[model samples]
Target chain A: MNKLCQSIRFVAPFLLAICCIACSNDKKLPFYGQREARITKAADGTEKVDTVYQTIPPFRLLNQDSIYITQDAFKNKIYVADFFFTSCSTICPTMHRNLKTIFDAYKNNPDVMFLSHTIDFKYDKPSVLKKYGQKLGVDGPKWQFVYGTKEEIYHIAEHDYLVAVQEDQSAKDGYIHQGWLVLVDKHKRMRGAYDGTKSDQVAQLQKDIAILLKEEN
Target chain B: MRKIVLFLVMSTVIVTLIYSCQDAEQLEYQTYYSNGQTLYQTYCQNCHGEKGEGLGLLTPPLTDSLFLKNNRTVLACIIKNGATTPVTVHGKTYEEKMPAFPKLADIDIAQIIVYVTNSFGNKMGMYPYADINKDLKSCATR
Candidate 1:
C-alpha cells in the first residue's frame, strides 16, 4: 500500500501537467456581447428570476438564387456572417479568400452555413450575386450571399453583428464596410468576431467553430 | 593529381553555368511579371481568379480567351476606365461592370498588361511602355 502511494505521487505531476496543457489548449469559447435581464413580479410581490441573453434579431433578405431567406433560415444553425460588396477592389477580395478557406473547411458540415451580406445591394441583386458566387466556385445552399434594403443591411451590420459599416462617397467604392467575420451559434448568439482578412484570426474562428460543434454534439 | 584538379574546375564551371541560367530566368520574371502579379492580386484576382479563370458568369476568364486575344488594346482601356457594357466570352455573355482603376499610372497599366498577357498559359509578348503610353493617350482623348 505504501509503495502504491509513492508511485502515484511520482506519476501525479506528469498527469497533472498533461491535463493542464490540454485544458489550456481546449479552453471553451466565451459568449460575446451583452446580456440583458428581465424581472417579473409575482402576485405575492416576489420577483421572478429571468436573464435574457442577447441574440441576433430576426431579419429577412434575398439570397444569391433569388430565394427569400429569413432568420428562420438559420434556425438552430451555426453560421459565419460578413458584410461586403462585389465592387470593392481592396480588402473585400482578401476577406473573401480567407472566408473561402473557412467555407471549404466546413463545406461538408450540415449544421454550418455562411451568410455574406452585400453592402452594395443596388448593384448586387440576386442574379449578380449568383454570378459572383459561380465565379468563386461557390455552389449549393450551404453558403448564401444575401442582399436587402441598404438601411436594413447596414442596421444589422452595425447593431446586430456589432461591426462597423457606412457609405462614403470619397471612398474608392463609394462605401465602406468592416472585414469582421462574426460567428453565430445555434441560438443566434454572437460567439466570436474574427478579422476576415487575417489568416491566424480566421484559423482561430475555425477552431472556435469546431468547439461550438462539439458543444452542440 | 593534375587530372583531378582539372575535373573539379570543369564541374564547378558547369554547375555555375546551370545556376546562372536559372538565376537569369528568375530575374527576367521578377523584373517583368512580379509587379503585374501584385497589381492583379490587388485589383483583379477577386473576380478574375489567381490563374485568370474568372469567376463564373460574373467575370470572364483571362486565360486563353478569344475576347482577350481580340481586344488586347481595349483591355488596357477597360482597366483604366471600368467597363459597364456587356462582353461575350466563351460563347456566354457577362454583363457585370468591371470598375475602373483611374489611380493606376500608365506605366503601372503597361506592367499589368504585360504580366497578364504572359501569364496563365498566354504566350503574348511583352507590352512596351511606349505602346501603353500611346494607347492611354488615345483613350483619354476619346
Candidate 2:
C-alpha cells in the first residue's frame, strides 16, 4: 500500500500537468454577434427553430493597387480589419505599429490577411494608400490598404464590424474613427474586437488569430 | 553562543537577500518619478516606445537627444501647446505633429519631465513645477 501510494503521488502531478497543457491548447473561441431564430417546417410537418449567426455583409472596395476587391477576395481567409486615414495624427500611428507587428508575424501565411479601410475617402485615394503602404513597408494582397466611398465604409464599420466611426467636422482632421481592430473568421463572422492602440490587446488578437487558423484546419 | 552565531549568520543572509531584491529606484524619490513613469506609459509609450526609443522616422527618439538637452524650456512649451511645425531631433527632422496636453496639470508636466529626463540614458535631474509653470505662462502669453 505504501509503494502504491508513492507511485500514485508520482503520477498525479504528471496527470495534472498533462491536463493543464490540454486545457491551454484548447482553441475553441466564442462567436460574437446577434443570434436570430428562424422557424422552418420539418419534413413531418413539425416546426423547428434555427439560430443564425450574424455575418459581415458583402463589401466592394478598391485596394492600394487600384484593384477592385470584393467579399470574394477574402472568401476562405481570416482577416484583421481597422479604420484609419493617411493624415490621421492621433491613435492611428500606434494602431498601424501594432498592426505591423501582427503583419510581420503572419506575413508569410497566405491564409492570414489584413484590411485597412481609409475613412477619408476623398483624400486617401488608391494612389495615396499605395504611397502610405509603401512608406510603412507593407505590400498588397497580404495586407491590403483599401479605399472606398465614405458612406459605404462607414456603413460597414458601424453596422457590420460593430465599430463606431463618423465624420465629425468639429474634430481634428475633419473625421473620427474608432481604434478597434476587428478580427473576422473565414466565414466573415466577427470573432473578436480589440483596441488597436493597445499592445496587450493586439497580442491577444495574435493569439486568437492563431486559434482561428487552427480552427479552419 | 552557537545558537546566537547561527541566528546572526541567518539574519545577515536574509538582510542581504532582501536588500538585493528591492528595487533601488523605488527606494529613492518614488512619488514624483514613479507617477511620471506611469503617466509616460499611459500617454507617451505608444509612439515613443517603452524606453523612449521613438517610432521610426515619424516620431523622434527622446533618449539622450541633443534637442531635449538644448530645448528644455521649449520642451515644456511643446508639452503644453503642442508642436505643429517640423522639429529636428538627433539630426533627423520629424514632421509628425505631436498633440498638446492642455488639460494636464503643471505639476503633471513637471513629473513627466522628471521621469523622461532621468530615464533612457538621460541624467538631467528633477524638473520642478515652478519651471514648468513659468514656461507654460510664457507660452500662453506668446
Candidate 3:
C-alpha cells in the first residue's frame, strides 16, 4: 500500500504538469486598459451583455519616409509600438535591439507590424529618423519610425498606449520615457506590454505574438 | 651537511623566482580580463551589443582586429572623451556620435581595453591601464 501511495504521488505531479501545459496552450491574451460592458438587443430580440475594449485612437504622424500615416495603414494588422529618439543613450538601444529580433522574425508576415514614436520632438525630425532607421538597418513599411508634435505624441502615449513620456532638462539624455513594447491586436486593443530592455520578456512577446496571430484565425 | 643546505636554499630561490615571474603576469591578465567584462556590460554593451556585433552602421563593432590594432593609440581617448568623427571599420563607415565616459578612471579604461581587445575573437594581449596616460597625451595633442 505504501509503495502504491509513493508511486501515485510521483505520477500525480506529472499528470498535473501535463494538464497545466495543455491548459496554457489554449490560454488567450487579456485585454488591457479601461473596458466597459454594455447591454444590447440583438435582431432576434434577445438582450446580451457586451464588452467594449479601449482601443488605439486615430492620429496622423510622419513616418521615417517623411510621409504622413494614419490608422488606415494598420487596418488589418497588429503592431508592436514603443517611444524613442535617435540620440537617446539610455534604455532605447537595448529596447530597439530586442525589438529588431522580433521584427526580423516576422519580416515577411503581413499580419505583424512594428512602430516607434520619437519623444524628442526637437531633435528627431523626419529626416533624422530616416538616418537613424537606415543606420539600424531597419527600413520599409513593415517597421515604421514616426515623428509628430510633442502634444500629439505625448497625449496618445499617456492615454491610449498606456506608456509614459516626459521632457525634462535635468535628465541625462534630455528626455525620459518608459521602455514598454506594447502589443496591439487586430481589433486595435492592447493585449500586452513587455519591457523592451529584458531579453526574457522580449522572448515572451515573440511567443505572445504567435499566440495572438493564431487567436485571430 | 653545509653543502646540502646551500643547494636546497638555491633551488628554493630559483623556483620561487620562476613561479612569480610567469604566474604573476598570468594572474594579472586574468584579473584584468574578468573585471573588464563587468565594466563592458555596464558601459559599452548597450550599443556595441553582447557579442560586440554593434547595431547596424550606427555603432562600429569592436571585433575588427585590424582597426583595433591600427587605432590602438587613440582607443583610450575615444573611450574617455567621446568621438564625433566618422570611423570606418570592417569596410563600413559609421558617422554616429559615440557618447563619452568621462567618469571612468585610468585603471577602468585599462581594464576595459584589455577586456574588449581580448574578447570578440580578438586575442590582443593585456593593455595595462597605466598605459592609457600616454594615449591621453597623444589624444590631447591631436
In Å, residue B32's CA in model 1 sits off its true spot by 3.8
Q: What is the TM-score of chain B alone in each candidate?
A: 0.75, 0.76, 0.90
- Mind giving the per-residue lDDT tens digits that candidate 1 earns over B88-116? 87787888788889888877887788889
**Per-residue lDDT of A154-185 in model 1, one digit per residue for the tens?**
99998899989988999988888789999999
Q: What TM value does the first chain of each candidate achieve?
A: 0.84, 0.85, 0.90
Clashes of each: 2, 0, 0
Q: lDDT per residue, candidate 2, A1-217, as tens digits?
A: 9999999999999999999999888778887878789999999999999977889988789899898999888879999999999877667878988898999999899899999999997899999888778656685678888888978888988888888888899986788888999999998888899999888999999999999999988
The DockQ-derived docking category for candidate 2 is incorrect
RMSD of each candidate relative to the true structure: 5.9, 8.4, 3.1
Determine the iRMS, in angstroms, of model 1.
3.2
- What is the descending lDDT order? 3, 2, 1
Candidate 3: regions farther than 4 A off: A1-25, B1-13
**Ordering by DockQ:** 3, 1, 2
Model 3 residue A112 CA deviation in Å: 0.8
Choose 2 or 3, whichever is better by TM-score.
3
Looking at model 2, the pairs that clash are none
